[model samples]
Target: MIDPLQIDDILASGGALSKYFSSYEERGDQIEMSKLVLQGYEENMAEVIEAGTGIGKSFGYLVPAILHYEETREKTVVATSTITLQKQLVDKDLPTLMKALGKDIPFALLMGRSNYLCLRRYLDNTVSQSIFASDPTSEDGKLATWVRTTEDGILDELQALPRGVLKSDIASDFELCLGQKCPNFSRCFFFKSRKKAESAGIIVTNHHLLFLDAKKRCDNDEDYTEKALLPPYNRLIIDECHNMDKNATSLFTQVFSYYGFLWEYRKLVAVKHGANASNLITLAAGIVKGKENEALDVIKELESAEKIINNLNSILVMSLSGSEQRVDKSNYSFFLSKYSASLIAIKQSLDKITSLLNSIIGKTAFSDEDSYIQQGINSAICTFEGYSSFISEFLNIKEFKDKVYYLTREKNKNREEVQLKISPLEVSDILRESIFEKLDSVICLSATLKVDREFDFFRNQVGLDQREILSGCFESPFDYKKNLLLLIDNGKVLYKNNQESLYFDHAAEKIISAVRASGGGALVLFTSYKMLEYVSSKALSELAGFNILIQNGELSRSQLLKRFRDDKDSVLFATQSFWEGVDIPGDSLRLLILTKLPYPQVNEPLFKSRCEKLESEGESSFMMLSVPSMIMKLKQGLGRLIRSKDDKGVAYILDGRMNRSREYFLSQLPPCNCPDDFLDESLERRIEDFLY
Candidate 1:
């Protein structure tokens, strides 16, 4: 249906793209990817493209996207996994493409509701504005004025925000928004973002917002094809497709914790130094015409909520309690009885509060100037009713068809928190029906999508296999084999069994040696924060000369990254978030060490449930579920080293578990020097040899 040569010529040298590049060399894999995208778009099916690093993956799909938009005048929604990627598109990628094409195509970035500030909430003096002085000369006044005049209403951009200002406190929330009924509706930030998407030719959004909007649009009875926050776009390009399952699961997951509830309680009604602070209860009472007591009755329901959760927390935390970490309908009867009773009581209280709010809303009418009071009251009602419905679903719990329910106690510094959680066992069907089935064409691409050198794992995991799919795994343009050496530890220090668990001490020595050899600028990836802490502690004293930064500490992730990048000789010890989205190329990052094979925790509620289900169906849960999932994670950890063609580094995996499927995982990576027999003592010298 489309001309392959047309896509190739546009990407080749001296073509339109040449104008946008400094050197202007062409990438074959990028062109091939463009063809796949164009074909997928014309044929109206899902396409999975695994473009390697430095292949210009964004431009691969973006070129065809811009062209398609120009020809058809139809929108294309580009979804990325994180805000950074979304910003990259809006700020960098699109501008280059638009320049090359010489077209002024309009595009907008839309984030979730909580990312933006709410003008109505910011103006509510009783609840939100009480902290700020009306004087424009005051510190709080300047902050308020800045918020009013800021270009984008994103709270993330506001650097001087006062402490205790929670995102939900002033951010645009679904329950808090009154839409056109509110006085500040004309200047509403959240909807203004959604409204900007209404006419744009291209809409850029992150995975969380994309999944949330998809779930919302699909859950409705009437068709919301042309409705909802997102504009009607038949085509979607989801980069970082590997994170689809995780994001979708998060969207479907529900959690209720005692501390989380307490925070909500304080937000609604709390006494600060015997003075009424910015809270919903006092605001509602003040708005009541003559029946202030009637309005304050909502606090009774809140008090009941607090009591029920406190009892539940106590029951779960008691030393003699029979409750296990995991909770379900099939669990201990005593735990179930107490848990259900607590949830039921909390739901009843929420319902009563909802009813009381309805009565107050009916009785309280405001002048046109004070319409925000009425709307704020209504928003509070929505918030309460939402929690009530959440509990209602948890009572029977959403059919429990493909869901995992669990209760766990987390120990904070001074207190223990009991939390109830529900997550989908699998999001395949949900995504298949909600996204793949509905969209005219869907394109899911990521560097680490193919685990063990096959797209089948990714396809099956994300419901892409259900339909006719076009897939390709384009090797990275960078020469991994020439640039990086893959070192595997299959020596005597490897884990003999799970319980012996003394591998970390040895791993720590290797990490210290490795960092010493490389002279710092190493990123050590661990399976958990505890392991990271252990490894860093073991190595910190020995490697005291090298500047070391560890995660879960004083510096934030961004701050840590900035410091690591600036100090090229510094080593960053982190887990999870640091594994990917880190793009330190050249001398700043020369060594990468993965301390262990990233396997799902045996105690993880959702993972354990998946394994049980697989076993119940007579499947090898270990082979079927765990190994492949880990390979993908391993691939991501490895992909960090060789970021660009000019960049060279040595990546070592300390975990011996990778040896079992070493060949399988190795085949997935670019042709590299994967040495089978490397001595532990000689690792430092070997890594030094490779780097120099």
Candidate 2:
């Protein structure tokens, strides 16, 4: 084995860690972890490190992983939790590290097929166009118009457009996709992304795609299978490891929607006289009818709706032309009005179907008494709820309504096969064995994994055996007492027992007060939408003239973040998505307000199952499962602050649970002292002092 790289010598070189990175605390942690990871790789063990806020852990692991691979002539794969972070590694961190290290390291960004543009979509809408040339003025015409302006059909780029635009315009399943068999294969974006990954030495991918690749392997072991995404690599590093469990779970479960069915019906209705109209409707109706033991009339209504949608799609395709400038105005308006109406009709039908499905659930005892049946019904209910939302969005006067198309697939393996629409629930096992187990060395790093410094929660959730697990914690460089303050406010009135709304009001009051005191620079974090909406309204009203932005509102997360960073007097209140992968240097944000203890509700269906399994061992469900999960999330939230040495902030938790309900959860939070006088009135002065 190679001698371990000297941490002192590496730090003295002051490579990428010195340039573009202002936090010494962050740089120091990176160097240490880099050394530890190299050593761990040499010893053939799993490394888990908890690097607190302001620790530039990304570069720390990335630089070392790249350098080690170079020195040893081995390949490495890096995994992160978010696409945003994945981009940072691919576009920013790795580039800087390579430059500083003076080595040309190969790297690639890999993502799900959906994340990339659908070349078939572009070609169908562009070259031998279907949505436009036949009906310039139709809804498909607008999609063609949007497609002309877009380089590729990447849904994310159309953020300025309405909701369904991205989902409809960009989404193309492998089954629905014509693949290389399509006339548009010459310029397929998905294949291009895959090619990029195939050429790279170090690959960056999210948890979803990582698991998706594994799922693909399970589905088909043939050439160009999903395993193609995970080329040969010797080392693996998974940042934000806490999210792996949920990511894995989400990747393993499956669900389908009626809105998709309704969209198809609307499409058929739009394409009334097209060649495939009747044939498409018949197939669509067959798929809808095969779902479950629904009432005959309900099934017939759904089939009729599907036929109508099929007709619409066919007509819309015929009316459009390839040239975007040749859009038919009158036809477009006609299709929009009729499309909206048809969608509303289908939505109403779906609502009835949803109610029927819900009523069928629990009312009639299942003769089979099998878990799969219950899972199917539960999926149906979820799909119904999701489709209801989609119908509402589609019927509204939304710009995206015209640009999107929806389709439903009948996944029938055989006549006797129980056709269950599938979506994956977990990627952990696949990630563990395929990536982690396959690696010569591995490091799973995140601030939130070990609650109370115990790796048991993260270990079991991530599916890594305890014997191979090695762990450590790196302290933050910031002065915790002087720069950071944790408010152990158990006395904050929660109005009534389990009153979520009251808790929002209480939390909002504290946040608004903090904004006032700090001259408006705070990020109030919430756990859910209802809480975010309630508190955002209150905070907005009080913090007048200050840029008080609420997440899940009018703006996207990135847009809100830009607005927050652009103005020193702005405050951003957001959810778990904003917990990590955010960088704000200087004093733009100095106060972090948490509305409650960040616990995944044990009552949520997925968590309920995990909790049941844990309870079977005579363990406290909250301590073993919920508490660790939340603590990791909370650490991620707290991490947003003190991004660099020039930054300092205060974190305030309004929930009494942190102090009262369970010590195990509380102990997992970042170790910091409470303010001598942690009151609302003195909050601003405290923050100002911390920053200055």
Against the true structure, whose TM-score is highest? 1
lDDT per residue, candidate 2, 1-692, as tens digits? Answer: 54545444445345334553565322556567767877777777788888766566776677666666677766677788887788778778788777766779788877776766665544432222443435646555655566566544445554453323345444554534555655656767666666766767688888887666655654564322224557655577888777787777666654323345554433322222333433223323334444344444445666765665555544444443321111123244664564566566656776776665554453434333222233344544566567667557434423321122222222221211111122222344555665455545678887666666677767776667534766788766666655666765555675344776666677777777767767767888877776788888877677778877777556878789888998877888788678777888767887888777777864453455456556876988877777677777777887787776656677777777565654555466555667545665666676666555
Predicted candidate 1 versus true structure: per-residue lDDT over 519-557, tens digit per residue: 998999988876788778877788988898989656768
lDDT of 1: 0.78
**What TM-score number comes out for model 2?**
0.71
Candidate 1 has its poorest 10 consecutive residues by lDDT at: 270-279
Say which candidate scores most in lDDT: 1
Off by over 4 Å in 1: 1-4, 123-149, 158-161, 181-186, 221-225, 270-279, 314-324, 337-341, 363-368, 389-401, 408-416, 496-501
lDDT of 1 at 506: 85
